[model samples]
Target: MKIAFVSYEYPPDNAIGGIATYVQQAAHLLAQRGHTVEVFTASPTRTGCEAFPGLKVHRIQPLNRTSFPQEILATFAQRHHVVNFDVIEGPDCGAEGREIRQQFPDLPFVLKLHTPSYMLAAISHIPMTRLAQARFFLGSLRRGKWPQSSPAYHYRADPEYQHALHADVLSGPSQAILHQVQTDWQLNPANFINVPLPYIPPAISLDIPLDTSTQRVTFIGRLEIRKGILDLMRAIPLVLQQYPAAKFRFVGPAWPSPQANLNMQEYLSQKLRRYAASLEFVGAVPLDRIPEYLAQTDICVFPSIWENFPLVCLESMAAGRGVVGSHAGGMAEMLDGGNAGLLIPPKQPKPLAEALLQLLQDPDRRQQLGGIARERVLTEYSLENIGQRQEASYQAAITRHQLKFTNSPSIHA
Candidate 1:
């Protein structure tokens, strides 16, 4: 099968957060499974891309100034109809879907909801101006409040909705996320599928056991509020109240927003100055070096308030650490209520702190959970498994769509 994935988000330019990770894993796995995969994405990375064997990648200049939107060149590319594909998939069917479908009306446009642009904007740096406009736009669209710009709303509002509605199926990372979106947008539940990523875990060895120390409670992610940096900070005080020996090491950039209202890195630095002796900020540690930090971590704490799925949690557990995270979005699904690792309630530091403390205080339990944590990720969320599932989904989608078209049935959304 030949599959072409369209997205504005791709690594080097901008990672679609966890979406990039999932796609890379999925595409690679599909290629390995005797399928040819091509990706059309914005080339934000300066070096074009390092290249992945068996996958044809095309990078287009961004259209909307925003990374996800396509440029005029992308518009041309979508209309060019130069490629041969048995199946086509995309991160979402928003403007890209609408514009592309204008040229290829019969193309099977699979509208994947990878947390959606609305959610991304909320997590990313939505300028107050955009925020107000977005909230108003989304609110009106949701409540049937027709704004002048109402012609343009979600991927559903794209002109292609009617043509692609039957051919298109909405997919997400987890059933939890699908349900959340169902309730959030009041979409028909029958239209969505809970197709979690069947991604293979990177073949890195985090085989080292914890050294049984509290000096490292690792935080991995772009330093931002969406990841619940503030909640994590608040829990720091609580964590110390129990395990006086505990210390924190924060990895990655401190903010997701390039345009900031308050610079989180500077803010955290100032805040950490109060506990400067106990905390370390190894700002934006290279991905290769993350294992070294995780190897030393007694526990992994993710205070993220929202996530469809967090690769960091998967990565942390893959590194064999007891993960403590908020029960929001896919974090809750990934954590599985500490069956895989701890799932703390969202927006609360108390449970998060307690979970961290529980692991920190008991080396034996931590080791047990940490060991199982890695196993669960490697077994269930492995790249091979995720890829296999994605392949199945694509095949199922193709077969289903082909049959429906052959039947010439009247399609209705």
Candidate 2:
């Protein structure tokens, strides 16, 4: 199959996010499977072309604009160099999907919903603000709190791309995402499929052996309130009351926004100073060094309020550490029926801290849960396994579009 993979981020840029990693893996894996893949992505670091595996990465560098991504894709439109494709797939779309359809009427286009543009528009600031406003005015909307509205009809009804895309396939990192997309867009269940974010078990080795000796609980992700950093901070007061030695270690990139990072840092730094000895912020560590940090830890405490299937949860399990995540979002699905790990209520510090304390004080239980999580990840979430599933989805979308086109008399040259 000849696939034109388009994304706003790709490797080396590290883009340092869940979606970037997933796109890189999917494109590379599909390329390895004999697909002639040409990738079109934004080069934040530098503008040019590069190659990885069987794919050629074309970097679309935009002129000075806060929202360079939407600007570049929307402006390029029919002018995009890579026009003809066996399938025109635009994931995480807004301008890309909308504009591609506007200019390329003959091309059969498909869109994948990562998350609703509205939810992002809500929490997102500055640069993303305009894109959000554009999305709302275009007919794409929000449904409720947890589930994002369908991105299907939203794209189809769009003035630019509405009539260009004849078929759509929806995917997110979890069942929760798929269910919401189906309900909001009024899309058939058959039009939606679940393809989880791919997990590449790091070629990491334990530099420091698991000592089975500490009651420290480690949380990996942005140190923001939504990530349950605040909840965990509050839980520390309670955790110390039960187990005096209980400590929480956080390792992730400081928030990407400087102002936001400063605000969060001041709060977390102040809390750390107040505790003086319990709260530890290891700051942002590279993805490769993650296993080394997990090596000394007994449990991973992911108290996030909402996550689109956290990649850190998989990383923790892959490192043979027991995990405790929020009952919300895709964490429950990652835990494999709740038997693989513990799932606690969101925003509630009492249960979250208790779950952490329980795992911390007991070495045997930690070992048990850790073992189960490792086995489950190897069985279900390995990059090799996830890559194949995503490939199948990509092919499925192509097949569905092909069938629809071949049967329709309107599909003409």
Candidate 3:
């Protein structure tokens, strides 16, 4: 199978988020399994091709300054002239999937769901700008016949929804995400498939057990308000009130947007300055080094306000670390309803602090939960297992596309 992945971010460019990790790991795994894999990504400094056995990384430099969607289409058009891909997949976080599908009508394009704009607008309590409010209002209108330049254009003319409506297949990382999309967009239940994210553990050994004496609680995500970083900061004091030995570590970059007036850096410097000695911000640890950090962490905390499927939680579980994640989006689904680890409400300090203290105070319980978490990851989220599922989804998409185009009854239906 010749698979092509279209993402703006890829390895050696920048690890923007989970999407980069997803593309790199999935493409690598497919290549290792003897499939020809090619990654098309935007690059500022480098252009042309870098090859590694079965995998080829194409860095695309747009000839002109255009919208990201147009840039992706331009790159794809150039690449399509050289090589034909059997299956093309891109993230739903951007317009790449829909744009590609629109340009290459005959090609089989699969839109992999991340977080939809509609869901984000619904979940986020951050006071919206008038433009954002209009966007939501427009989303409530017709699904496909939206104006291009309206203020609500981005929301109403969502590329993810467009891709889902017309693509060969629409897939997401978890059932929870699929359900949310179906409910919010009023789409058919059968239109979406559950193709779980693949987890390839780092080269580092997972034999090291966390030292419980220091009680290290680690949060591995961008320090944004939506990620519950502020809530986690508030929880630290409450946690210290009970478990004095608790030390916190935040391992990622900070994202302070214009709409949200809060400054994480200032908050950390001023409000949480007294506990600065106990809290360490290992700013933006590389993806490869995450296993090293997890090895040192007794408990992994992901107090995100909302998420589709967080790769951090999966990675922590694969590293044999007990996770204390929020009961938002796919956290509870991944944790198996608190069976593997603890789940607390997001944006609440007391519950988060309580969960942290409970896990930190008991070494035996943490070890037990960690064991369960790792076992679950091995059973369900292994690369081989997910690869097989993904292959099946692709084949199904291909068959559906061929049958539908042939003027035959829809095979998927």
Model 1, C-alpha of 312: deviation from truth (Å)? 1.0
Model 3, span 70-123: residue lDDT tens: 766767777777788888888776656667777887787777888876666655
Runs of candidate 2 exceeding 4 Å displacement: 64-84, 93-95, 105-110, 121-167, 205-211, 256-262, 271-273, 406-413
Each prediction's RMSD over C-alphas, in Å, is: 5.9, 7.4, 5.5
Query: In what order do the candidates fall by TM-score, top score first?
Result: 3, 1, 2
- Candidate 2's TM-score reads 0.80
The predicted structure with the larger TM-score, 1 or 2, is 1
- Superior by lDDT: candidate 1 or candidate 3: 3
User: Which has the greatest TM-score?
Assistant: 3
Off-target runs (Cα >4 Å) in candidate 1 are 45-52, 63-83, 93-95, 121-167, 210-214, 256-261, 403-413
lDDT of 3 at 268: 65
User: lDDT value for candidate 2?
Assistant: 0.67
TM-scores of all predicted structures: 0.81, 0.80, 0.87
Provide the lowest-lDDT 10-residue window in model 1. Answer: 158-167
| lDDT of model 1 at position 239 | 80
